[model samples]
Target: MQKPVIRPRRLRQSVAMRNQVRELNVHPNELVLPVFVREGISEAQEISSLPGIYQHTLDSIRGVVNEAAKAGVGGIMLFGVPAERDAVGSGATDPDGILNRALRVVAEEAGDAITVQADLCLDEFTDHGHCGVLDSRGRVDNDATLERYTEMAVVQAESGAQIIGMSGMMDGQIAAARDALDDAGHDDAVLLAYSAKYASAFYGPFREAVDSQLQGDRRTYQMDPANRREGILEARLDIEEGADIVMVKPAMSYLDVLADVSAESQVPVWAYQVSGEYAMIQAAALNGWIDRERAIAESIVSIRRAGADAVLTYFATEYAQALRAF
Candidate 1:
């Protein structure tokens, strides 16, 4: 064979060499675990669609938070499944509600060890399973939903949520949440805006994870997957509204959106490796289609490379442990 003038494989010679040449790395602190707490359940129930994920009881949530803290995971993003749902999602603003209670428990159990974030959306509490309240016309009431989110923010702050994740796609949600938190004297509480969330088919598993009661699609509010510029605009609006961090959901499918937001956003940009993404990898791995461990590491690393300051993932603890081992 003729001698090659240049050999690019020189850098791929060994594990240490690859590590040295790697430009992006996923640290334990860059992974945030997404957890669910369900009301009226004594034991944790496995989410069939999400495989290893579960709808945890209050006690189980505490245990999971403790484990995440011990694993050196960055944070836990909490979602609550209420025993009852209402038209206005009254449970969301109830301090005694499942989510708020879970927040208090996790904060008390692992506050100092890890960041505790609360999902500030009302989907799990609303009978309609929409992120906001509905109008008499049966459409999502944008302004009315903002009012609910404002109230929800205050309760979440009081319950010890270090960060409030505004997952609702309401027009003025970030501004409303920030104002409410400040008025309630939670000036230090961070707001993580789900700025560029898309109406994706990839959220099927998450619907099951949170026991979502969504009746119709969120396409009216959420960004269209085909529109890249709209995602950038959403992030800009959230940042202008005082969001401490902004996120793009379904990280793998929206990496371009994530990267664009990260570039434009002055604040930290995070990404969510949503339930369907996790389930897909798990299903493939279980069927012997790929290396489970390697797939997990690569997925998050790819998100990191795409400009996520942190990634909320179902594999957070596992990925953190794997990083520690490396």
Candidate 2:
């Protein structure tokens, strides 16, 4: 019997040939870097779990953002590590809060060259790991959290954030934030809905970066990883509710969902390379198992190949610089 009609192996002969036949490629403009900036700190504090990642001080954040801008990254996704927490998560909506301060700085440095995106979730401000306030039964209150998101949207826009990243995994969050932004005359600012965020174990190191106060799981709010079709449903709901951009969290494990959503959605699709994914690569590199730079670029490129128009990753600056060197 004939083995094959065409020689597929020919494309694998050389680096140039492989690249020429590569169907998917990662671009510099598609990379969005996630940065952790603390409220009050003298120097950058490295997160042991996420190597090469740090919680920068306000002064340090300015320099970091400036450097990322020069690297030609698509944008900076900001997460503020507050020095304090409360039941209501007041720091999230406060104009003087760390997040707002960083947003202003990022916007100033970027100035339309890149989108300054702010994580609009309350988990970073809450005393509990839950993304929202607790009810009398100690469960996350979805409706109440929506109200908080509305208020937070206004604050973020006021703080000069070009985009609000709804990463709390809460329902109705996109609609509520959109209404609030429109009412506050920030209708132009984009709402990037974390539409298919899952309650995955891959978020372990992120807890350290933002100093999460989570005691239990986030199953009720975040999607269950067992469900794939449901991600498409959630993405649809978010688009109908006014999300300017829809995203799937932890890109590597859920690339199928991202691809499906990208095919159906009218707006742009994005994916997040969560902390766990970053830590795994860092650990392998530290132990001399893999080339860190190549792994970082390859991982991000895989996500882009999976149908993400943009990606939120910790390696945005490094990857962008690498892409430009080509």
Candidate 3:
């Protein structure tokens, strides 16, 4: 046989060799854990749709924060489940609102050990379950929503959130939030914009986690998955509006969008491996259809390979612990 000129498989000859040549590494500090704290729950409640995740009570939040900190995870993204919901999502801006209160508790527990981020959106607090206020025609009032977001941003900052995750996808939201933060003397706080969040079916498990009362889809505000160029455009607008970090939601299904946003963005790019993605892996693993740990590792690695500077995932703690062992 003729001698071959190149052998690409040489690098794959052994685990040691593969490890040495690995171009992408998923580290504990690059993983962010997403947590939910319910308003009136006296005890921790499991989110059945999202296995191994809980709707923690205020008292229980400390335990969750301690566990995440112990895992050496990069950050914690907190979501609140209010006991009551209403028009304009009044609870969102209230200093004692579930989300705000949870932020305070978590910040106290975490201190400066890990980044504490709040989901600065109205959907969880709104009885209508829409991300913002509605006009007389029942359509999302974009400008009105921006005003609410500005207020929510300040409250979250005052509550000790190091980062505010602007996930409503409202127009002018970034500028409004930045201005509000500066005016309120929270200029030190960072804004993480969900610049390319899509109205996705993948949000199903999340709805269950938050007990979302959404009557219809959010297609009017969120991006359409069919459009890739728009993702880059959204990220550009956020960057121009003083967003410290820009993110693409439902990361796995939108890796193409994530990659595009990452390539063109000047700031750090993050991706959220949302609830459905997490549920699917858990379900498959339970059925013995996939190696749970390997799948988890590969899923996050794919997101990293697609250019995410960090990943927000339900499996963050487990993945971080595994990386620690390695």
Instruction: Kindly indicate the candidate among 2 and 3 with the higher lDDT.
Output: 3
Tens digit of per-residue lDDT, candidate 1, span 1-326: 99998998999999999989988888898899999999998899999988889999988888898888888998999999999999999999999999999999999998589999999988899898888888889899999899999999999999999999999899989999899889989999999999999999999998988878888799999888899999999999999999999999979999999989988889999999988899999999999999999999889989999999999999999889888888
lDDT of 3 by residue, 1-326 (tens): 99888999999999999999999888899999999999877899998989999999999989878888898999999999999999899999999999999999999999888999999999998999999999999999999999999999999999999999999999989999999999999999999999999989999999999999999899999999899999999999999999999999989999999999999999999999999999999999999999999999999999999999999999999999999999
Clashing pairs in 1: none
* Candidate 1 Cα errors over 4 Å, as ranges: 1-5
Best by TM-score: 3
What does the lDDT come to for candidate 1?
Answer: 0.92
lDDT of 2 by residue, 176-237 (tens): 88888898899999999999999999999999899998897899889999899999999999
Q: What is the TM-score of each candidate against the true structure?
A: 0.98, 0.96, 0.99
User: Who wins the lDDT comparison?
Assistant: 3
User: Per-residue error at 230 for model 3, in Å?
Assistant: 0.3
Taking all chains together, the TM-score of candidate 1 against the true structure is 0.98
Q: Which ten residues in a row have the lowest lDDT in candidate 2?
A: 58-67
lDDT accuracy of residue 268 in candidate 2: 97
How many residue pairs clash (N, CA or C atoms closer than 3 angstroms) in each of the candidate models, in the order given?
A: 0, 2, 0
Say which prediction, candidate 1 or candidate 2, comes out ahead on lDDT.
Answer: 1
